[model samples]
Target: MSGCYIHIPFCAQKCSYCDFHFSTNHSYQNEMVEALCTELKIRSESWKDEEFQTIYFGGGTPSVLTSGQLQKLIGQVKSGYRVSNQVEITLECNPDDCSTENLTTWKKLGVNRLSIGIQSFNDEQLKWMNRSHSAADGLNAVRNAKQTGFDELSLDLMYGLPNMTAEEWKSQLLQVIALNPEHISAYCLTVEQRTALSKWVKEGKLTVSSNEQQSEQFELLVSTLKEAGYEQYEISNFARNEHYSKHNTAYWQGVKYLGIGPSAHGYNGKERYWNQANNKAYMTALKQGNLPETIEILSSFDRFNETLMIGLRTKWGVSKLQLFEDISPDKEWFKIVKDYEDQQLLIETPESIVLTEAGRLLADGIAAELFIIN
Candidate 1:
């Protein structure tokens, strides 16, 4: 099934480690809403026959938008595209934005899922990350979401902070478990270039976590979540009762999705396109009835490599027969797979080949090694 992603590129404050396309300007909210709805209308013509199974509002902060703004955008999608009755609508919210009133409003608007960005419940860490929410606010948000009756709830956590000890990481995980969220996404803290965190590291103002520490924390995360009856469906995501992020899962499985708004990416199986990152340019183009984007037609090699990279990261590995058919007659590739299997890094079943627990640590490396360089 296909999905639709709406990018909200406005945030109250930029996170220290975030490098995603976002602006702290709230003045352009109304204009952005108009442009987004217009873009959705323009793109919906191609998908008139298609029905979306999931609708995700991802962003700098989707919660930053008012209920009216959100409704207008959702209304556009309802009128312009065919959405399934069981569509999973998700909105990414920060803890501070999860007020009872806001939660009730979103629930009424049919937002079935809420992915709260509670990076850390520790006050110091929250401050370090430049998040607006306090530790109390994070806990209160979860309680409020649960009380508001969201169909599914997910919490985002980060580990491998330079100053976070093993015990502290454990505390964070336990706190999340206590909240009883349906899904949990734990990510390693990586300092991307051009981000405040990266600059701090380069200036010797902040220390970054070592690879060894990150690895240990990752192992801890998997074991702790597994013990809590959560399935590690993806490398960084854990879910209970099969309540996985259908939108993200579909993306990994090569399902086509329409991306709305600036800096958004869309894939249509054969070709991928991304909108211009600049908000002004995006709005101007939409006003002029043009799509401000670049498209790339995927070659066979590109498709194969992407399949391997994305497929191997999930609990569902690449289909053995399909992989063989796609990259058949390549003895070298077969040899590489054999070597990995022999090393116990990959487990081969009759239907598919999945990574072992140890292999997961080197997932990126393994995918890279198996890439079909053209």
Candidate 2:
């Protein structure tokens, strides 16, 4: 259950809301591709015995890369690592890049899944978000992918925007449902520091939605998607017929994986590693035969806290037996769990601790509250 994640840090246009590491400058695109392959080979020794079940092309925008570049990268993966016969290859595409030609080429190259970033289908909202594509582009992208024989389609939808109404949020979900994608990842928009959205917040140019509104929208998302026959597998992910993102699911379950490219993070069972976020620095390091990465050794407390934090965010929940594998739960930890259980915020079954819908709204906070200090 190992996965490979390749980060392509090139974006044609930087969205105002984005704070992720990416550059609008693509002058070194060719060099970056070569550097990525070089890095892949450099790190391949760690997982030589294991086969990668999934390979994800995530980004700034993977769709910005050409067909030749994609083939080169995928080709590199096939040759460098032990791959599975039915490897799930996913590419995160922007709507404008999901043309018929692009989709067809991707299909031929064994790219089975398309995770299109259709943040919102409203033209006004798209402009507000400074997205590259129009609402029409998004609709056609899904149609194009389906026509090209791609069945495993996952669409990204953003909710919790500034001053959003329940009805408006409902409309967005309905639009996504009409597209009939195999998976839907709906996220709440947060104003991150240094982002334009954050600037707007500081200057009072935009007002964020109320907590009550956000809660209503989330509840609405759960109900509407459930009615549409999509299972809310994770807090933000809905899937039809269990078309889970193999790479991300493996991550939640604490499976080891390699993260290739600048700003990408990787994990074995015990340690975590992250590459340099700067593109030039990363390329320079690889060119000089040096790895531009930092490594962290996880303490027992770190492991226990992570297990509970990530495990509680999904429908599968945290296994009760595995909770104490790293360290003993302190008195306050037991008290917190008991309180949440009594409030019906979470369930304490014989085998697992699963969050109820109400509890999931406060999941991260609850997980932190229950963390044990070493």
Candidate 3:
């Protein structure tokens, strides 16, 4: 089944660590909405008639949109695409943007899933992160969503802060467990270039977490969540039973999807395309009847490398035998896999090469080590 992702490039305010395409200017709200709808129409006509199983609204903050604006966008999607009756419609929201009224309206507009960005329950952490919501706002938002009958709730949390203690991390996890969300996406705070967080670190205004601290927090997360009966479906995601995010899992499995809006990426079985990240440029090009995107045709090696990278991040490991089936297995790939296996970092079954729990802690490094150099 195909999936669709729509990026809403507006936020209440820019987060310190966020590098996503977004503006805090409210003046462009109406124009942005119009451009998004136009993009949907433009992309939909070119798309083959595939029934969509998932429709995800992600962004700088999708919750910034009003209920009326949301209804209009969903209506456009319904008119343009063949969405299945069982579509998993998700809306990414921030606590400050959610209220009882808005939650009811969101539910009415076919939003079956709510992904709330509740990074931390601690007010200090929230302030440090420059989030648009308070700790109380976050707690209220979850209750409002549940009251509105959204059982498919996923909360985003972050660990590995510069001054956070292990006790604080454990406390946050316990609090989340108390809320009883269906899924939890816990991420380590990474300082990307050009973000405020990086600048603060450089200027000595803020301290970044050391590798050891990050590793410790990750271990705490896995052990704590597992004890609470959550499965580590992905390296960074935990879910209860069959409630894993179908939309995200489809992407990890290399399924075809259409992405609309500025700074969005789409992948078919063969090629990948990314829309222009600049909102003004995207709207201007689309208004001039252009798609405003760049495409890359994947080679055999490229596809193989991608499959290897994505497969390792997932619980469903990649088959070593299947690697040779897709491309000529070279000594370089074999050496990397064998090195990891010998270290007990990877468990090599006859059919699959799976990451051990320790290996998952260093997944990016392991995946990078296996990249097919051109």
Candidate 4:
């Protein structure tokens, strides 16, 4: 099913490692909300007939918005789109943003799931990440979300930090497990270029974790979560009782979704669309009743590579029949697949191809090797 994503480009404070589009300034929030609704309306003209089962509020910090701002945005979606009765609406929030009052308001606003950006429960790491919340705030957010009737909870964590230890990672995972969230997403910390993280690394002030350490932590994460009854449904996500993130799952499976607000992206089966990364430019164009976006048409070559890139990172894997239908694999490509299967890194079925546990650690490298370079 199709989905709609709203990017809130406002954050209280910038995380040290974040490279996503956002502004710390709140002077234009009202204007931003209006612009977002406008874009939603403009894009809905062609997609209004499609039934949407997921609506995700992602961003700089969706929790930064007030009840009125949120009401306006969700109201716009309800007015313009064909949302299904079983639609799952998720809001990305920071721990400090959660309160009984705020949680109640969010629930009334049609937000059924809360993807809280806990990041870590360690106070020092929280400060290091420039996170606005304390460890206590993270704990309170989860307790508060459950108390407010948000059963579909997803908490985010970061592992493989610079100088992180195996014991430390295990402690963090246990903290999350104790919280008993319906879904948990753990990400390996990467120093993306142009962020404070990269600057520190370049100056030799910080040492990023070695690939070997990260792999060890990843394996630990998989086994620990599995013992706790959570399924590693996707590479970075774990869910209990099959409660996967509908929007993300659909996105990975190549479902079409309309993205609202600056720096958001939209994709259909054949093409990809991304909005202006500049907030002012995005809002200005929307005010002028235009879409500030670039669209790329996908070729068979492009589609085939993309299928393997994303499809191999999941539990369901990619359909072998569908992959061949997209483009014929060359002799070399087949041999690479054979080598991986022989090593038990890949499992090739007549119908599909999936990564084994050992294969997941090398997921990116393997997928890259299988990529049809232009």
Candidate 5:
């Protein structure tokens, strides 16, 4: 029921659309890797009694780690925590790093899943996004992973770019389907502040897609993936039945997990904590044997809002009984639920409150509107 996440904050180059925590500077790469191992040891002491069902290597790019580095990290996990035989170990990789040699080494090291970031299948799009790999690199990466006997492969696809025709979007989806990955996660491109994409837009060097185009592309993704026999497990994730990602699913299920390394967040049932985002600060804190994370004690209202927000994003939906009990059966909640139901945004059954497909597109707004003030 619990999981572990290790953040690897290194990338060959920063993507124009990325605002994630990472650096292309190799000056501290060796130090960072050592510090990460030290952080893992410090984080795992409390979890020695519990077993993890999933261990995710997420980040700027986990594939950047060498075989030895990867092995040593997994070794620490095995020695420090009670790991289950059925644990899903997923490594998030960039297409340029998914070589045959690396895939084979990862397989030997017990990595059960590979989530490759393919973004898009058009070279122009890749260049526009400042991605390091070409479309051919993505195709080859998938082939290499499969050739190395990896059955649990997931591909990340991006859509809703400026000047990207609907036909181009369809072609991208079709190309991914032809690759026969067990799972596909389609994400809509957004221009986040502080990113090169945002700067370019401000400077009139880049244009963002219209909201209508984004919505249309999202609809296209759902329909195309459904027709291709992939279940829309989440709003953005599609998978062949039983191939859903366990690591991410645990988050939606509100399972407790421990996160190690800089910029990582951890949740243990009632409380949540997040580590320092700066690498130098994180290393200094860990060197002093301190767990460098900000802690938050969840109030009842906080818990209710979170459950309502995250639970509604999944296919399992939020249980009506649980919701009623989690939050008081107050006039505010009752009014919110009734209003949403009247709008046909939610289906209220005896057991749960589920969002219809139409409601899902506007999920964040709906969840925000329903949030209760303490």
Candidate 6:
């Protein structure tokens, strides 16, 4: 099924580890909102006949917007697109921004899921990450959201931080389990270039955890979450009672979706497009009745590589028959697959091929090894 994503590119402050396209200067909020609606209207024609099964409000921080602004944007989408009655609408919120009143208002506005950014349960870690909220704020936010009847709650957790011990990581996971969220997205902290974290590491002011430590933490995460009755649906995502993130699931499944707002990316079956990351440029282009996006036509090889790359990381692995037919017709590819299976890195059933737990640790490398180079 198809989905829609709206990127809200406004944050009160930048985090040390964040490299997403967002601005601290929110002076252009009203202009950005209007521009977003205008862009939505212009792009709605393409997906007019298709019904959207999910809508996601991801961002710099979607919680920064007021209820009125949220209502206006949601209304614009509703009027323009054929959204399903049972559509799963999710909003990414920060701990400090969540309140009982706000949660209730969001529920009233048709937001069924809340993905809270509670990166850590330790105040010290929060400060190190430059998060706006404290540990207490995070706990309170989850309590408030739960009290407001949000059964579909997701929490973001980070591990592999510098100087973070295994005990600390376990404590964080235990605290999250105690909160009883429907979904948990645990990510290993990577130092991307141009981020403050990268700068600090470069200056020897901060030391990232060793790869061995990171791998150990990842194993702990999987084992602990599995014991807590959460299914590891994806490499980084754990869900209870099959309450996976539909929007993200659709994305990994290669479903076509429309991405609205600055710096958003959209994918149809054959082509992909990304909006300009600059806020001023995005607004200016929309105001001038032009769509500010760059489009790329995907070759068959591109699609095949993407399918293999994404599919191997999920619980539902790539279909063996389909992969053999669509991606590689040569016996050499089959030989490579057989070798991985022999090494116990890949599990091959009659229908599909999936990575074993050991293989998942080297998933990217394996996917690259299996890539068809011309």
Model 4 agreement with the true structure over 112-225: per-residue lDDT tens digits:
999999999899988878999999999999999999999999999999898889999999999999999999999999889899989999999889899899989999999999
Residue 79 alpha-carbon offset, candidate 4, angstroms: 1.1
lDDT of each residue in 255-372, candidate 1, tens digit only: 8899999999999878999999999999999999999889999987888888888889999987766556556537887788889999999987888879988889999999999888
Better of 3 and 4 by TM-score: 4
Please list the residue runs of candidate 3 whose C-alpha ends up more than 4 Å from where it truly belongs after superposition: 319-325
The window of 10 residues in a row where model 6 has the poorest summed lDDT is 320-329
- What lDDT tens digits, residue by residue, belong to model 3 across residues 1-374? 79999999999998999998898987888888888899888888767577789999999899989888889889988899899999999999999888888888899899999999999999988997899899999999999888889989999999988798899999999999999999999999999999989999999998988889888999999999999999998899999986999899988877889998999999887899999999999999988888889999988788888887888888887756645556776787788789999998988788877898889988889988887767
Total residue pair clashes for candidate 2? 0
List ranges where model 6 is wrong by over 4 Å.
321-326
Question: What would you estimate as the lDDT of candidate 4?
Answer: 0.92
In order, candidate lDDTs are 0.92, 0.91, 0.89, 0.92, 0.89, 0.92
The root-mean-square deviation over C-alpha atoms between each candidate and the true structure, in angstroms, is 1.1, 1.1, 1.6, 1.1, 1.3, 1.1
TM-score of each: 0.98, 0.98, 0.96, 0.98, 0.97, 0.98
Better of 5 and 6 by lDDT: 6
lDDT, candidate 6, 1-374, per-residue tens: 69999999999899999999999998989889999999999999888878899999999999999899999999999999999999999999999999888999999999999999999999988897899999999999999998999999999999999999899999999999999999999999999999999999999999999999999999999999999999998899999999999999988878899999999999988899999999999999999999999999987788878888988888887776645555554888878889999999999898988999888888899999888865
Candidate 1 colliding pairs, count? 0
Worst 10 residues of 4 by lDDT: 320-329
**Model 4 per-residue lDDT at 234:** 92
Q: How close is candidate 2 to the true structure, as a TM-score?
A: 0.98
* Tens-digit per-residue lDDT, 1-374, candidate 2: 69999999999898979999899998889999999999998888877987999999999999999889999999999998999999999999999999899899999988999899999988888887899999999999999999989999999998889877899999999999999999999998888889988898899988888778888898999999999999988899999999998888888777889999999999887899999999999999999998899999999889888889999999999887777776877687778889999999999888989999889999999998988777
Which portions of model 4 miss their true places by more than 4 Å? Answer: none
Q: What is candidate 5's TM-score against the reference? A: 0.97
